[model samples]
Target: MPNVVEPKLIAGNANQPLASAITRRMSIHRGVHIDLVDARVERFNDGEIFVEVFENVRGEDMFIIQSTSNPANDNLMELLIMADALRRSSASRVTAVIPYFGYARQDRRTKPRTPITAKLVANMLVESGISRVLTMDLHAAQIQGFFDIPVDNLYASPIFALDIREKFKDRMDEIMVVSPDVGGVARARELAKRINAPLSIVDKRREKPGEVAEMTVIGEVKDKICVMIDDMCDTAGTLCKAAELLLDYGAKEVHAYVTHGVLSGPAVERISNSVLKNLVITDTIAAPEPVKGCEQIRILPTAPLFAQAILNIWNGTSVSSLFETSTMEPIYEGVFRS
Candidate 1:
C-alpha cells in the first residue's frame, strides 16, 4: 500500500460477472477499497476488438481480470490489447489476472503435426506487455515455464477442501478422493491428503475405434462417498461417464469438484441426467442460463481467493501462504451446497 499509485483493475467482456465479483471483494478486503479502472471494451462491426482507457494510468499499477473461456480467441485479444494500452499509458506494472486460462489443455503435442497451444498462449500474453501473470489451476502447470515474466499460479484445493470438510463431516471416514483418469492423479492426491481421505484412480481405455471407453476403478471405492477432482470439466462426457461407472461399482454416492467449468456443448444436460450428486464449479468462467438452471450443478465463489492473492501481491507479501493455510476462512454463500 506504500506505493504512490493504487492498483487499478479492469475487465474484459469474457466474464464481467467474475470481474465485478473480484472488485466487490477487493473493496472491503483488508480495510482498503480498490476501485475498478474506468475503461471501455467494445467490438467493431467487423468483429475487431477495441479498448479505450478513460483514466490517466501513468505510473499506476494495473491488473486486467479476464477469463479466456468460451470465445477464447476474442477474449485473449482483449487481454493483449488492454495490456498494450496500459503500457502505452505508462502504467508502472501490469498483471494479467486470468481466472481461467484457455488453450492450456494442449500443453504438449499428442500426435504428429500438432502444436503446443499452451506455450503459444504464454508467449502471446508476454508479448502483450504484461509484466506479470496470475491465474488459477492451469490445465497444465508446466505452461508457467513458457513465460519469462513472473507467473503466480494459484490452487483452489485449499478452498475446495474447506467446503469438503464441512459438507462431509459425518462421512469423513467413508470419503474417497477419485481421479477421473490417470492424468489427474496428482490433483486427486492433493485433495486426498488435505482431508485425510484415501485416494483412487479411474483407469479408462478404448479397445477400438468408435467404441465405449472401458473404465476400471484402481482402488476400493465400494461403499465410499467418491469425490472426484479435476482442473476443468468440458463437455462432461468423460466426467459423467466416470461418475456412472463409480456408482455401478457400488460407490454410495459421487461428487465432483472442478476449478473451471467450461461446460460447453451438452455439458449442462449431461450433468443434469448423470448419476452424480452435484457438480461444484468455481465462478471463474461466467455460467450461462442452462448452467444456472441445472439443479445438479452448484457454484463456489473464488473472488476472496483471488482478492487475497492480489492484496498479498500488491503488498509484497507471501502469496504462497494463501495456498498453504488450512484455516483461512473465505467469504461464502452456503446455498451452493459445497
Candidate 2:
C-alpha cells in the first residue's frame, strides 16, 4: 500500500459533543486509534478567536469537526482559523467535517446585487488551506461545486430509513412521505421509496423568507400516516403550517424528519403547539435546552456514519458504500441513494 499519516480529530467550539462522539466511535475499531488534538480554541478578551494546538501535528492527518450552525459568523471563523492553524502546524492534510454548513441556503443570487455567500464561504475555506471537506445534507446540492477541494456530501437518509422502519414497521400500509414544500420533493420522494410508502407534496407559496402565504396538499394523505421531510427547520412556520394542513386533510398522524434543526425564534414553541406528532432531527446541529426538553422532538446520532466515512477517507477506500442504505439484498434496494 501507500503511506498514510496518523489521523487526528480536532474539535472547535461549534459542537464539542459531536466531535467527541466521532472520536469515540473511531476508537472502537480494531487496529485503529484516533484521539482529539490537544488544542485550545477559545475567544479572546476583545471577542477575537485564538487557536493553540499543543500537540505536534507535523505530518499528521487532521479532521476538524465543526458545524457552522447558530452564531454562524463565529463558528465559520473558528473553522477557517482552525484550518489555517493546522496548515501552519505542518499537518499532512486537513479535512473539515462541517455537519451543518451555514450560508448554504444563500447558494445562488436570489435578486439583483445579491451575493452568493455560499460560494464566498467556499472560497474562504480554500484560501484557509483546507484540503478537503465533508458535510451532510447541504441546503443546495450544487453548493458542492463551490469548493475547489474535494467534497464528500453525506446524507442522513440511511439513518432516517432505519428509524422509520422501526417506528412505523407495523403501519407501513398507511405510511406516506410528505415534502414540506415543493423544493424538498426529491428528498421526501427518496425516503418514500425507501419505505415503499406513498408520496405527497405540500404546495405552498412563500411570499418572503420564513413566511408562508398559503399551503395546499397536492396528493392523497387522507387516513395515511404522513411523514414530512426537509433539510432544515428555522422558524418552523412552514413546517407547522404544513402539519396543520395535513391534519385538516384527514391524515392519521404527522411526523417530520429534518436534518438540521436550526430551530431559531419560536421554532420550539411552534413545534410544541403544532399538529406534528413528532419531529425527528439529527445531531448535525446541537440541540439547545428548550429543544432537548421538547417531548415531540428527538435527536439521532451521526457519529458512526461520519467515523466510517473518516476511516474510508484515511484509508483511501470507497466512501460511497457508507451511503448505501438498503441498496441490495443484504437488505432492501433503493432505500438509499446509490
Every candidate's lDDT = 0.88, 0.89
Cα lDDT tens digits for candidate 2, 23-134: 8778875356777999999998999999999999998889999999999999999999999999999999999999999999999988999999999999999999999999
TM-score of each: 0.95, 0.94
**What TM-score number comes out for model 2?**
0.94
Per-residue C-alpha lDDT of model 1 across residues 280-316, encoded as one tens digit per residue: 9998999999999999998888888888788788888
Runs with alpha carbons beyond 4 Å of true place in candidate 2: 1-5, 31-33, 327-338
Candidate 2 residue pairs that clash? none
Residue 309 lDDT (model 1): 82
Question: In model 1, which runs have C-alpha deviations exceeding 4 angstroms?
Answer: 1-4, 206-212, 330-338
lDDT of 2 at 259: 95
Q: What CA root-mean-square deviation does each model show from the true structure?
A: 2.3, 3.5
